[model samples]
Target: MAVLVPYAAARPKTRLSDFLDSPERVSFSRAMLADVVDAVVDSGGNPTVLATEPVELDADATVEVDDRPLSTAVNDRLAAAADDGDDSTAVVMSDLALATPRVLSRFFDADGDLVVAPGRGGGTNALVVRHPEFRVDYHGTSYLDHLRVARDIGASVREFDSMRLSTDIDEPEDLVEVLLHTDGRARDWLLDAGFTVDVRKGRVGVRRER
Candidate 1:
């Protein structure tokens, strides 16, 4: 099976703009992608980065540049691969900093026509497509759309759940999870940049200590 890591190179992590400037967002997003790529490589899968533009990644992976929205790019690639007789392809998110090789292995070893790792707030974080009829939709509540599509097409579906795959760092609340559970490059970057978890007024959150 081939692993494809899709990334938005031009403008990544826009939701974190309030916390990180444009350059900082790009740097942090790249760091997270590196961690994900390392985990995919460790899991014994060949990884190809699918990017919106030509962006250099410091990892042992190939790049496929496509100047299209994530959903369109990924769908086109998957369809083309299926046409080329590639039986299985896994589309993994680039922000899974806490992902481990074991978790990824489990995902690839799952027994089904389709394996899905659903993210918080109705997102599909990672997906393994073994059936030719299964395509991807990444719009709002995409997990539900994928499930229905798989069932409609008579594909056996399996949902794989792990903290590593599910914890995609998209929002500020996500930072708390990374700081508490992960020690990857993203976590190290946050720490080096003076970010800390703060507990006050019966609430838990992140704060810049510096």
Candidate 2:
């Protein structure tokens, strides 16, 4: 099966800027992408990065550039793959730092024409499209939109739910999730950068020891 990883090479992961500097955000984004690619490779899928610009990744992946909006680029690629008679295509987000080969294998092995793994706040973290007629929308509340679209197109749909697949590192709050859930490079980078979870006022949040 073909796995496509869409990455924003330019100005990536802006939400975490409050905690991470620009350079650190870039480095952390790349580290998360590497972890996702590693899971894809370990799952025995043909992994390719659909990058917005030319950026290097250390993991085993081939880079393809499409500077268009994410939904457009991914939809166009899926359509072309269907035209090429490919059976299915998987689009795995680049920021799933806690993702593992087991989670990815379960995602790819889901029994349906359209399988979706929803992110924490109404985003699509991963998807597998087995039907040529199915497409995607990555806008706000996209997980619900995808479910509606799948049903409208008469395609069988399944939803996969797991912390490993659902947890994408986007916000500052997500740093704690990574520290608690993953031992990957993203977590290591956070620790090396002096980030740790601290409890204050009956709530837990990430903090930097400086």
lDDT top scorer:
2
Q: Write the per-residue lDDT of candidate 1 for residues 1-210, one digit (tens) a residue.
A: 699999999899999988888998999899899888988999998899999888888887899999888788898988998899998999999988788888999999998899999998899999999999888889799999999999999999999977778888999878888788777788888998789998874668798777
Judged by lDDT against the true structure, how good is candidate 1? Answer: 0.89
lDDT of the candidates, in the order given: 0.89, 0.91
Candidate 2, which ten residues in sequence have the lowest lDDT sum? 197-206
Put down candidate 2 lDDT per residue, 142-167, tens digits, no spaces.
99999998999898989897888888
The alpha-carbon root-mean-square deviation between model 2 and the true structure, to one decimal in Å, is: 1.1
Q: Which stretches of candidate 1 lie over 4 Å from their true place?
A: none
Steric clash pairs (candidate 1) = none
TM-score of each: 0.96, 0.97
| Residue 183 lDDT in candidate 1 | 74
